[model samples]
Target: MSLVSQLKTLATRVGTEIKGLVRPDHPGLARAWVNFGYVGSAIQISSSHNVAGVARLAAGRYRVTFSTPFADTNYCWLAFARSNTNSNTQRMAIIRATTDTKTSAYVEVICATATGSLADTTEFNLMVFR
Candidate 1:
């Protein structure tokens, strides 16, 4: 093949590899993610990818359902939260593994106040990886 043809073939292979790396089902990409918060006592999802829905079970507890289920219950997850209250308290977001499944997971947001109470946060973000 001519030099130009060889270069063209190499470029096409590179482009195909890059597209595979960024596919939605790529292993390096998050399987599901959601950004949610409360709006006047109701849970509101601000943005999401592969997340079907979010439900508030209690004060700081929530259930996040995925649009596509994982192969098993071996996925990893991350959570972050920030309170809306004007206080200097620290906050923590935790995933409840006991309630985790191929289709959904649970999260709880807690505040580091005197009571170490579970509280609704102004913003909550969750991500899942398989």
Candidate 2:
């Protein structure tokens, strides 16, 4: 190869090596740098209906509430389902985000009453980020 071509190849190889060294499989990190928690809820109901308004649980709800940090954004996901059913009752399933002073987004899971006749106590699983 010509001298100029050989020099170009060497510079490319050196750049690649430097990048590899900068990013290892795992860098040493202190445990304090990681934050984690859980939030959830449970509720009971006697009839079929949709609950209105948002309740601010320990872990926030996922509906598009004014308080939802992700309400204005399109990058949020909601996962919920009813776990039990009978002739006299149905449960509401809900998932949402948790907000702090910084309003960081987190996941929450819960089941509530769809009808006013039933009662539900919600327990959420919360997780704080790194």
Candidate 3:
């Protein structure tokens, strides 16, 4: 190939790599749930308490597989809802996993610090991706 053509090809290859690194692939959607009395309030990441759930998929009655990547140790990089449809009461936060495998996460719901509305119950659906 000529010099100009070679340069163009190199540029194209670099562009492709950059795009792949930056743009993540959407692995469709998946779901998880919390029980009625689960205290999913806030990202409780501490030496004493680390509140997080592993994203997983079940394979019949044999093996358990995690669709998303998760660490054995927990961190405080998740979000949760007070209820099913209370967007106003939902707590949003930026979660950063320890790895970049783009799989799995541990999320927590923000807690309410009050007398009447401190404790709550709810279930939530998580958008799973890789």
Specify the highest-lDDT model's number: 1
lDDT to native, each model:
0.72, 0.35, 0.34
Superposition error at 68 for model 2 (Å): 19
lDDT of 2 by residue, 11-54 (tens): 99999998877653223311111111122343322221112223
User: Which candidate should be chosen as best, given TM-score against the real structure?
Assistant: 1
- What TM-score does structure 2 among the candidates reach? 0.24
Report the lDDT tens digits of candidate 3 across residue range 26-106: 233233323222335432222112213432221100011233445442322333334434454442222332432332444
- Lowest lDDT sum, 10 consecutive residues, model 3, at 56-65
How do the predictions measure up, each by TM-score? Answer: 0.71, 0.24, 0.24
Instruction: Provide the clashing-pair count of each candidate structure.
Output: 0, 22, 8
Q: Weakest 10 consecutive residues, lDDT, candidate 1?
A: 104-113
How much is 39 displaced in model 2, in angstroms? 14
**Alpha carbon deviation, residue 54, candidate 1 (Å):** 0.6
Give candidate 3 regions above 4 Å deviation. Answer: 1-26, 31-105, 111-118
